[model samples]
Target: MVFSSESFLFLFLPVFMAVYYATPQRWRSYPILLGSYVFYAWWRIDFLGLLVLTTLFAYLMGQRVAAHRGSRQGRIYLTIGIGGCLLVLGVFKYLNFFVDSFAALWGTDAAGLGVHWRLILPIGISFYVFQAMSYLIDVHRGDARANARLIDFAAFIALFPQLIAGPILRYKDLEHQFEHRRHSAELFCDGMARFLVGLAKKVILADAIAPLVDLTFGASDPGFVVAWVGALAYMLQLYFDFSGYSDMAIGLGKMMGFRFGENFRFPYVSRSITEFWRRWHISLSSWLRDYLYVSLGGNRKGAARTYVNLLIVMLLGGLWHGANWTFVIWGLWHGGLLALERVTGWHQRAASYWLALPLTLMLVLLGWVMFRAEAVSDSLAIYAGMLGLNGFINDPLLFGAMSRESIALAGLAALVAAAEPKLWLIFSNAENKGPSGAVVSTRFPAASAPRAHASAALAHQNDGWTVTLATLVLGAYAVFRLTEQSFSPFLYFQF
Candidate 1:
């Protein structure tokens, strides 16, 4: 179940949290593992076994790697562990794509080739497999110790908050928290506030604007205006939708006394594509950087090799998203741009925001066209319309499909997406100010005070009656929409 669903929000979460906190500290992992399994099984019971098997395989392999550290056996174990994870991912996620592509290349029908089996990809397979691989690699590399307890390791692997769609936590990042974490009224309140904000972003904003995007992209021959409008709508929809889920995941992590790293950071404001990757999907980008790019020798190689490495990493990174040619092309498109930036020094030009922002956004918007399209040809058609190769006319069908509410919400979403950084800064400054125009300090032990004060500051920022009223209104509206509208699955869930 997604976080935005009524059953999940109203039923599963409350019950899970109640059971979780009520369990004793020593046996808490039992409830967490069980709850996490139940959450995964809610999607498909059969895949639950696959998840367990993968987790156990990684755990065992990690132990072997740790036991044989600094030896050939350790490297062997590490290779086996990573290979096993990738094999599972490839079979489930990419098998069909590979088969079809091969058949097409060979001028033969895939069905006649006797490959009749069709794999149903488990939800979140990509995310959890990456985490499992990272865990094994970290253990082998001596960055983290292999967990002795199966339950703790399993809990870490299957943490429900991030199991489905993730900020992609590494084992090292969460190892200590799995063993010891504190839950309190302050953290819970802060988490609730964050969750509510994300809920509004998804339900009130993203879902509202999704229809216009659907109408335009689904058109037989959308005009230039329709195509651009749809593309822009989708740009806003994707940000709010995926980032909203990330926010919910993070907020849930906080409530459970675990800290997930930031995922998105006002990527729309990026002045360069390089800067955009740094801000967007921070976890995945860092993962590719460390595991893929670094493994390919990174920039330590010459400029020419660095460009090649960049291309290979991005191409594979795109393939990791899905078994689709559009994703591959999307990856290649970004890789080419990144390489051009490096070779031409456009990235270092220090262009002003007025010049840089639009250019960067336009590039990003064009990329999203490929990402959202069902096929490469559809993406090309959208691109053609975007470039005015189709027609400059505003399609009446497209204009008629958008409601006034959607248009207004789209405008609001764009404004919020652009202004969110400044809005947060203003709120932060206001939160730090005291009634007497001075900073308030709490007296506590040095180590404890900072954590306490930070939590307090978050609570303070969200504590105002105005914030409360706004949250309630937005939440109520979102709930109303949820009850009335059809299910709107998260976009990233397909990956």
Candidate 2:
């Protein structure tokens, strides 16, 4: 079930938390594991078995690999384990794509080939498969020890928060947390704030912009301005939708006493493709770097090898995001840009931030069109429209149909969201200085002893007034949106 759903947020989470906290420390893992299975089972009961079976198989193979480490047999087992994971991924996710391609090339109906198997991809199959493969490979590489306990290993793979659309948690990162963890009131409160903010971003901002995107994409011969509007709205929608989900996942992890890493680092503000990768979907980038790039010789090799490694890593990275060819091209697109930077030593020569930043953002924006498109031709068509090749915006009907408030809000949200880091920094610095930093405050500087003065003034703002007001506003908006049946599934769930 989606974390944003009413049942999940109000019912499932509260019940899970209650049981989780009530369980004995030693047996805590049991309830969490069972709860996770129930969550997955809500999607498809049959798929839950696949998750359990895959976890068992991978965990067993991981132990075998760890035992045989540094030997030919160990490598063989590792390869076999990885291959098995990929084989399952391919069969469930890529079978249709492959069948269609084969049929087209051979002029034979793929359905008549007798090899066609209609498979319903288990929810989170792609994510957990990658996570599972990473575990086996890390064990083979000696980066992490294989867990002897089957339950512990299974929990690591099936952890519900990151199971569906993940920051793609690494085995090594979470290995210790599986058995040992620290919980605190402060972390729990902070997680609530983060989760609320993420919920607002998705339900409020992303949902607000989605219809514009849907309309633009759904049109026949979309006008140039309409296409640009659609593409821009889509870009905003994607960031809020995916990043919002990531935020919720991270917050849930924190509340559960698991410290998952932040996934999005304000990637919209990145100044280069390389910088963008470092900021966006950071965990996945690091995963491919450590597991794939390093295994493929990494930067320890010369420039030639590094370039080849980057391309291969990116190509697979794109495929990992989805089974579609567009994703493959999206990966190659970034790979090519990275290669260009390497060859020309452009990354070494820092251009003016003014020039470099927008250039990077534009490149990224264009790339998103490709990533969002259903097919390569649609991407090209949309891109052409974006460049004003299609006379979309001149149509008065589109403009007149859109609410001025929505248009204004869309523009404002994009600008404010892009400036998120600066905004957070501003509030943070102000916060450290005490009540003096707050405008229209009741207390003046040095009205009393420093700590006491700060405490009294801080009490005014922190008395749940601001939080209650914010919550009420957001809750109202969420209810209105929910009533309208305007919920949009998170973009990254497919990954």
* Best-matching candidate per TM-score: 1
Give the residue spans of candidate 1 off by over 4 A.
351-353, 426-463
Candidate 2 per-residue lDDT over residues 1-495, each given as its tens digit: 887787787789999999998887667778778989999998889888889988988999999998999999999999899999989899888887788778768877777676556666676888899899999988988898885477777888889988999979888888788778988886676566567667777887887887787776666556787788788888888888888888788778878888788788888877778888988888889989988898899988899999998999999989887778899999999998988888987666635457878888788878888888888888887877777777657567875666665667679778867788875444323323211223333555665788887787677557445554565577567656655764467778776
lDDT of 1 by residue, 295-413 (tens): 89999989999999999989988998999999999999899989988998878873654698899999999999999998988888888888888898657756687788988999999
lDDT of each: 0.86, 0.79
Residue 350 CA error for candidate 2 (Å)?
3.9
Q: Against the true structure, candidate 2 has what lDDT?
A: 0.79
Q: Name the best candidate (by lDDT).
A: 1
TM-scores for every predicted model: 0.92, 0.90
| Clashes by residue pair, model 1 | none
